[model samples]
Target: MSLLEKQPNTSSEFEVDSQRRHEQDAHLDSKLRTLRLLDGARAGATLLALLMGLAVLGTTGHALQAYNTSRFDASAGGAAWLSMWPDNGAFDVKPTVALVVGASLVVLSNVIALTSHHRFVRARLAAAHTPLTFSAPFVGLVVAIVAVILFYVANQSATADTLLSWSCRWRFLNTASPAPQFASLCRASHAGVDLAILLIPVEFAAFVLAGFELKLQRYTAAYTHARKTPSPVLA
Candidate 1:
């Protein structure tokens, strides 16, 4: 071919290469965002759930232990048995149930995250840039809702216990006996028990937050795609 003809062909080939490179870069960028969703955020969520689950799991053991202890009653000491928690007796059920439910969700979150995000640690596809597929958002949504409900149930149980305990007579049943007094430390301990009981539910909330983060992940992915794709040109 003549030099002039070859020149035009080279120019055309160069343009094609440039377009191909641009598309490849855009594709790579999209995949990176997907990795961040699955690996970065999702992994973080899984870790959060695992940690929360461990915490609530420990509380479950403690609650079970407390169940074996004596119940507070009329003959009980004034400030010592003032926790006002289900552990005070076998009559309460909410806190125990809350502990189980929260732990279940924590396990579920970790399972979903690990199973879906396995590709991050091990390549499952021929193309390393392929984005990880996300499952339904409903799984996380249900977990989040149930977790919140259980959390409130536990809190409500604690509140009722506290009110009832406070109203109980703190006096010894004997001749010329007066109402017993609680020390400042005991008073703080009473409040501390109430707050400490809430820790399990709070950890459960963290588990739910990790689950709900998937919603944010979806929105972010959609926004990223929109920004990467060029707008349609009207002729």
Candidate 2:
């Protein structure tokens, strides 16, 4: 073909290539937008998990304090003998503390993952540089499982004993009785346990989303790099 004829063909080919690249870039941008929305959802789940954990800790602590106060009252003589929570004695505070710690750790790990993701998306950090981010989901998952086990043990301990009966004492006991206060405390304590159980799904969801986010982030990074890099020219 003549040089002038060949020039037109080359120009047409270049135009086609440019248009294809533009379309690819647009597709990647759409994927990134979807990823941002997913990240937002993950953060929301993590926040909810944190709130529920705090509620468990507060209600359980207040209940234990009230139960202890009841032990000092003479009118509620039998209240001291009542088992309103785990462990045979008045109430075992250790398990509750352990569960709270585990749950807190789970929330912390999720937060770390979310932070890492944000940094990565902003190009301020690389996924490889943040090793903790990769492991955060696993850590959160394991801790959540441990917290759930502790909750199950606590639930079993309370259910197997007279805990439920004591918690409901306010309904059966006279309103003038000092034991009603003890019953309220017992009920609150168990409510904390219930809250923890109810939050298990949320905790799992946060970790799951984190894991998915991590994988998607790596893929997106690779795709972006591949698209941006100049391909090897054939001689």
TM-score, cand. 2 vs. native:
0.73
Candidate 1 TM-score to native: 0.47
Q: Which stretches of candidate 2 lie over 4 Å from their true place?
A: 69-98, 107-138, 154-165, 169-171, 174-180
Clashes of 1: 0
Q: Write the per-residue lDDT of candidate 2 for residues 1-235, one digit (tens) a residue.
A: 5999999999999999999989998988988987787678877876777677677767766665565565456335655544433454644455556555775676677667666657555476663424555466567667767766875676456434333345555434444454436456566767776876777787778767767777777789899999889999999
- Using lDDT as the measure, which candidate wins? 2
Segments of candidate 1 deviating more than 4 angstroms? 1-10, 16-20, 26-30, 33-38, 69-90, 119-141, 151-235
| Candidate 1: clashing pairs of residues | none
Query: Residue 172 deviation, candidate 2, in Å?
Result: 3.4
For candidate 2, the per-residue lDDT at 17 reads 92
Q: Pick the candidate with the highest TM-score.
A: 2
